[model samples]
Target chain A: MTAKLSPRTEIRLAGEGGQGMILAGIILAEAAAIYDGKNAVQTQSYGPEARGGASKAEVVIASGEIDHPEVLNADVVVALSQEAFKKFASSVKPGGLLIVDEEKVDSTSAPQAIRIPVTKMAFETTGTVALGVLVGLTGVVSREAIEKAVTARAPRGTEEMNHKALDAGFTAAEKARK
Target chain B: MAVKLMQGNEAIALGAVAAGCRFYAGYPITPSTEVAEVLSRELPKVGGKFIQMEDEIASMAAIIGASVGGLKSMTATSGPGFSLMQENIGYAAMTEIPCVVVDVQRLGPSTGQPTAASQGDVMQARWGTHGDHPIIALSPISVRQSFDLTIKAFDLSEKFRTPVILLTDEIIGHMREPVELPDFKTIRSEEYRVTAPGQEYIPFRNESGDVPPLANFGVGYRYHITGLYHDQVGFPTQRLDEIDPWLERVNTKLDKHLDEIALVEEDYQDGAKVALLSYGCSARTARHALKLARAQGKKVDMLTLFTIWPFPERQVEALGERVDRIIVPEMNLGQLAYEVERMAGRKKVRRVVRANGEMVTPQMVLEAMEG
Candidate 1:
């Protein structure tokens, strides 16, 4: 009997409408497709309202063409708000990583979560929600790919601050692993 | 040249620029508004022109006017706005103006859902303008195909000297993917230019071929244009000799060039008993279902239609001969399926449809396959 080596990676990012989660998904997808030379698709959902409503973006990166673009059971889920954390906590696959913003999300019920002070770190460095979770998912992606993508896709004049946010996220993930 | 992650709407706008389309006039409508927004930002950089008109009606008129001025022009809209632009679109057809209209469809008999995705505009695109005039429509199934087919839409519009419609639903219009676009210099189609000067020019004359070279209005050419059936010199004519041949030429130009304008993708397994025919958003579901069916040891062929109008009857006829059953899944209820039943026999056709602004699932298609 033969065994499969690597399966497709599905990542879902959930937050409020103004947190730039859609842009974050695009950055991650660009990293996988343009930098790593894989196939990636990014789909997003948001309420009619432009901001303050629930928003979510899903990214699927595969070594081959993706048949279904939507994420069925996400391999990694990042929740940036209490509502999103409650909604998507159970949709992660078994043994999958569930990342929550410790300062903003109430993780009282999820002991298995890898909680990080993402909002605080991002605010201190970039003065915005800088997609620290995307940086944390570099364990699945790569540091170089995320770095290049962040540098390339970020808005003009914010490159230096976004790089600092990326460094902070990488450091936080390493410390959590310990 | 460069690989970039782009939304499908953004890619279409860039593809238009790459195809040497230099003028865009559109009114903003949901799911399709981004096409206008991107062009507003990108057009001026390429020395092209972009104008947000008072409404979709004027937007359609402006593009037609720009095309008559010898610049390739285009517009984008959704259902309600598309409904508004039909009159001018018919005018463009009657005058044989070469332009492109992109309808990034959303759910609607009337404003059903602003942001939701649906393939409900297939029939509207084919029969929207209230005439039996010739038109071409293409539906793209993915973000990358959206870019490629938008270029093809311009190419066909210029080559045939007729208005071409790109009928895309919100799903493919909004999804983001990484694409390596072709160089603009390499992919651009040749622009139309007048061969003769003043008094020697005939605006609608086809001395050698079916299509006549269009001359810009101010470029030392004196001619008249109207929505009425006109003679080759562009004047309204009541005589059958002038009117009948004009109608014949305008209506049959696309039919004569079906080989070049009808774009399709076919994946057939030898001796497969069933084939799935789909386009736009539903093509995504059809492909996934085909993969699932193959995994379960079923033989199913797939055909993805890029060109939806002029019907691609040649390819449909060929597929009908090889397969016993044909399955069609669209967002609307049996719109394209009705045509499939006609070509492939009603007894051999199966339809799976939904119009509630939600995608048809792969499991739904698989169950229909098993049934």
Candidate 2:
């Protein structure tokens, strides 16, 4: 079943510090704001450690002005690590969407979650594949918008690779939906 | 201009450059470090100077020195660094050096949390430095406001010849929002111009307005600047006549221009008996709560203060007279609420406060409204 979203959609991307979740959050916000002409605000919180600690970035997208720049009850939660899943899964609203990395997060506790091998796909292609998977599953932002944002923000010499990774994510989402 | 998604700290750095800021000296600190980082890369592209000072004290001193040498200068820091810069901040005020200090407050008292948000420095921003002094503190509620307010901070500092504080918190500093910045050519900042020739210049002469024209050092106008009480020519003095005038001018300069300096947004409904008042990150929460409260058929007024210092007493007192009660939500333990209470009366003001590194939720403010 397709995930239903509210007028104000709150998305939380959680992973380890080095996993580029913060960057994913920024790209997602840009996709909604710059490309789709929606209002978006992205805020992040991480541990003091630079790496190997739980980090989460939240994006609040709305058709109107976003007064509170944080996720009160996340409409979509993407967890790429077991710790992230444990910490943020409960924050997802009832009947909300949860997409977990199948290999990294063992149990989402929500049986209806859409599980995908996000990190493995990133290992095979590019590290930004999870963001692509998120957009594919929820379609919170248009696919073309996300692609443009990712390309605009991609590192030098890695745009093509990241584009391929996003294609793989969409393919996986298509299979899961079927 | 195409809209670009920019973080609040990054917007501040770009805003500084747009406001004709030619020098940045700051020590890296969480949340606020992005301001220094962006400036470090972008300053040189515009023929501006950026220095990674050894500490916040040195950073504060460096900005003041640059300003004295005739550059629009700024420094950014968190709470600990803000504390270290207190003495130099007072020095800037005493000498009437025009500079901007951006304080991205985190959970504080002393390095309480490196990555959390707080409005704990509201009082500190006003009175952190010792003694009575005039200060202009502007706080922004959004990333776009962050950019706009940073430029205002510089303009106000130059126009007032006083140190201005951009007192933002971690949430507003790190959050990202899409902003279409105005063209650089369209922006105007107050420049320090000495109309009087070097021979006829009196650095602190209160001849016309409260703010006397300042001349950059090494520009032929040689004058003494000290932390001590000074005369019209900036010379050190102990006499009552010289010190009294100096104190009067420095203290009341900002007060005379309260109409121009106090920036606030007032949203009032017809015959609204309740009002919501807040600033900085907390203002965002209050705005959300105002919508929720109004949706539930509550007549509520909301006031968002962009300029926090020099208090904006007249507007707030006027608000107090109009409303039966005012609610304040802030990410601190009643710092600004105290001011609201003093203006609106103790029984007429209620506070929804949090100091635990998390924002004051909109629900909390809504509950306060109901209570």
Candidate 3:
């Protein structure tokens, strides 16, 4: 019998410095902790420069204690930059999922990679760059959970645009779903 | 009430929040920046404010200013920034402002490494500010203790109307562990008696404690606060007799609370001939090392210090008499080891120091403990 997926999910948001990778993790953690009423832990590391630095944020959503916060061999690695993929793909354990932005990330080696064109969709829907791309990617991997998170978390005036951007991401991820 | 896994850095920020700190200002520095980062995001949500100032000096100053405006305030920094704020920290001491300072220490006499651990700031935390002052500094090894002691830092800072220092190393700051956060109301900040209405309010007058009741600026009361020596009315004092009382008042509070402030964790206390005296992250390794020594039929007792300042002179002296030889395994050349040697009142002590940034393991401390 095929066992069911546990409610516990560990996700990573990665990109270049200006990619808003940390915002994705922050929203995911807020959603889980504030809405779903589950435990969450968010950890990140970024290099010195704010522009070209490689940045990654790990969000672990578990029912119990999240020991070893470094995200030892993440079950899901989201790569938003080519540099980020090169750095994080090796750290993802085998059989775990890989979510990649097809437009920015060149994922020739990711075994179970899902290619979602978050960049193109982001530009088309929101007319902005980073926030749209972040919302799109966040909504895709998080499914409908990102909507509640964004509505609860986004600044008051930016809600309508963020909601639209999240929809764009969800549609893109659903189309690319294998 | 959720017992979630948290890093020590974030826990310190959470401790600040639970302790009713509504104002935070700091620049981003390694190991300590995470505290500011966490506070920056969460503070706005809780109706508090967080500011990333131009630099550490301005960051430290902004917090001091905000405290005078009637807000429980704090800032966090590592070694290099800590050196920059020494002059302002002295200002807080002289003015007797109530605030907490968190130093997640890193390796440095200067800008050495952004991610390496070191306890080289023991003496710096004690006497970093110029002139004479008695400061309360706490060292936390784990994430849970970091949260707990941060609350204590604010409590002591407010109770004594002085700046309290939370001295943590990079190892503890970066290390993540499970911690159960207590209720905000449960996290207590001492309530010192305020002055009665209409009557004169002496900002530096106290009947119960050595520290006076701090009166915030523009709180319908007028009082002078300066970096120079001051008397009961808060005016700067230059008289020789007043200077003696002024220095005595500052030193006596910490000295009086020395016994109560002393925190030690003793294990395997069977009159062990060899005593391992250590603190901070180095002591975490000693716990395992002492067990190995005990398994080998070696009599070893561990004295882990949670309170680093005021030396815990009496408790340390008592332990000094009980042990034949004291081994202080630290991360610096010889900071806390010097204190142990002084309290022991003899050269019957050895030091196992490491500055390599990769903690001194049990094997290293064991080798020193054997001799």
Candidate 4:
């Protein structure tokens, strides 16, 4: 059964503790597991400090059961902070996708990288940066699956703002692609 | 069936409710705290009861009392809290009460790393309470299995009229995964009923079966219940005739059902030379490592145990005979390895362990396999 899911896609989301990356990882996993009907496992590791500490969430999406939940060599790395980018830049698999926040990360080590002004767009629109990066990840995955996950997981009264942020993210990723 | 993406802890709570567990009493602890939280919210909606006890000791006692009053009951805790519940847990075992105790183990001797995962309590779950007794402990490696095994735990506890432990860890307790759970309406638990009025009801009658029928306390069945060695009438007994039979019945009930109690998953390839044995979260590590090894063209077989306690001696011995070397990886420092060594002999069993907060990675197990 696992043979069909050979070369599983691993996504690593790295940022500070309070940036909602854990929730973002869960949304990504839900998109794969519930919306896409693929087997997915999401795990997170954070320091004792609640904020301003290195934190990471990893999701392994496959067509079969996920044996190890931890991400080893990531197929996609989303770095929302300079610290996160410097630490996890090398952990990405060769020729894998590296998405970075343009203003946040200065490292240019990744040969093939996509820069999205996620924080600036969020601040200029929703006044929060977490959902923007999460939505932009959809450009790398299934847009419909991620949008559905955001609708299902986002708290009430914030759905409209989140949807708008998601649209902005899609636009930003599209512009980066061009 | 509706498929929902849920954390292992939430699935466990839902599993308990589906198993007809109506009462839960627990004090919060890390990793395992979510089980209590979910149950506290869901149990009420299902016409069940949930209480936050002062501590783990009271929590264990409360569940025992609820079970005696004719409700399926459970409690969840971590290593330190589990230690505090030992005395009352033995009380449930001695009284033959039906209940489930969930121990989501963390790294520990005393207040050890709370958020980290570990299989350190394997020995403690089996021998935590003193005296000769029989116990059933089931460990699940994935979130889906966590739900299924919780139901199984309740079923086994009710069937054998004993306390069963749902042994899990922080990794599975916190990891979120998609699962299509079993339909609740189709699930059935072993039944307990009152002896019809006017007929003599012996709570500990040891004649027909090892497990005497347990009647709910308030269901017109007036019987004494105690923690001491008890006679057929439930009164404390010291006589050899009464004590010997009571002791024998408790110990052999699980032994007789060893086939039902010992559940394992084996993946063997033809002409495989090495065997990797693991349980709980470490089993995931073993499976990942096995896949890596197989991908590299290494010949290895894997045995994953869902049943941890009353150790799967027969299965381990067979694996030991089939392969020249056996590797045991656990979150603790060789807790389950000790039992594997005892069964497969110390020389054949190799131990790979990590006690830190982090998980045992595939690389660690792969390196041990290569060595």
DockQ winner among the candidates?
2
> Which ten contiguous residues of candidate 1 chain B have the minimum total lDDT?
B190-199
Model 3: per-residue lDDT, tens digit, B1-371?
86555678989999899888899999889979889999998888788999889998898899899987778899999999999888889889888887888999888889877767899899999899889887888999778889889888888888877888899988778765446788877765666635344656777663333777777676578777788887777787888777777777777777667666788787756758888888888887777578778889889878889989867888778888888888888889989988898989667678888986657777887788755
Summarize candidate 1's per-residue lDDT along A1-178 as a digit string, tens digits. Answer: 1112136788888888877778788888887888888889898877788988888888988988776677777888888889999999988888777888888898989988888887767653421233555455445567788888888886899888888887777777767767
Give lDDT tens digits, candidate 2, residues B1-371: 68999989999998999999999999999879999999999999999999998999999999999998889999999999999999999999999999999999999789799899999999998999999889999999988888889899999999899999999999999999999999988998656656345467878875434788788887787789999988898888999988888888788888778998999999999999999999999999999989988888989999999999989898899999999989999988999989988888999999899999999999999888777
Candidate 2, clashing residue pairs? none
Off by over 4 Å in 2: A124-127, B195-199, B206-209
Q: Mark the regions of model 4 whose C-alpha exceeds 4 Å error after superposition.
A: A1-6, A48-52, A102-117, A123-140, B193-196, B207-209
What RMSD, rounded to one decimal, does every model reach?
3.3, 1.5, 7.6, 3.3
Q: Order of all candidates by lDDT, from best down to worst?
A: 2, 4, 1, 3
lDDT of 4 by residue, A48-134 (tens): 677778888888888876898888888777888899999888887776767777888886776566777767777533212444443
Candidate 4 residue B7 Cα shift, in angstroms, is 0.8
B188-226 in candidate 4: lDDT tens per residue?
876865635556788888763478778887767778999
Fnat by candidate, in order: 0.62, 0.94, 0.00, 0.68
Better of 3 and 4 by DockQ: 4
Q: Candidate 4: deviation at residue A106, Å? A: 5.0
Give per-residue CA lDDT, model 1, range B185-297, as digits (tens).
88847766673465577777734338887787777888899998788888888989787777777778777688888889999998799999999989988998999899888
lDDT of each: 0.84, 0.90, 0.76, 0.84
State which candidate has the highest TM-score: 2
Best-to-worst order by TM-score is: 2, 4, 1, 3
Task: Summarize candidate 3's per-residue lDDT along A88-125 as a digit string, tens digits.
Answer: 87766665667677888878776467777666666433
Deviation in Å, model 3, residue B260 alpha carbon: 2.3
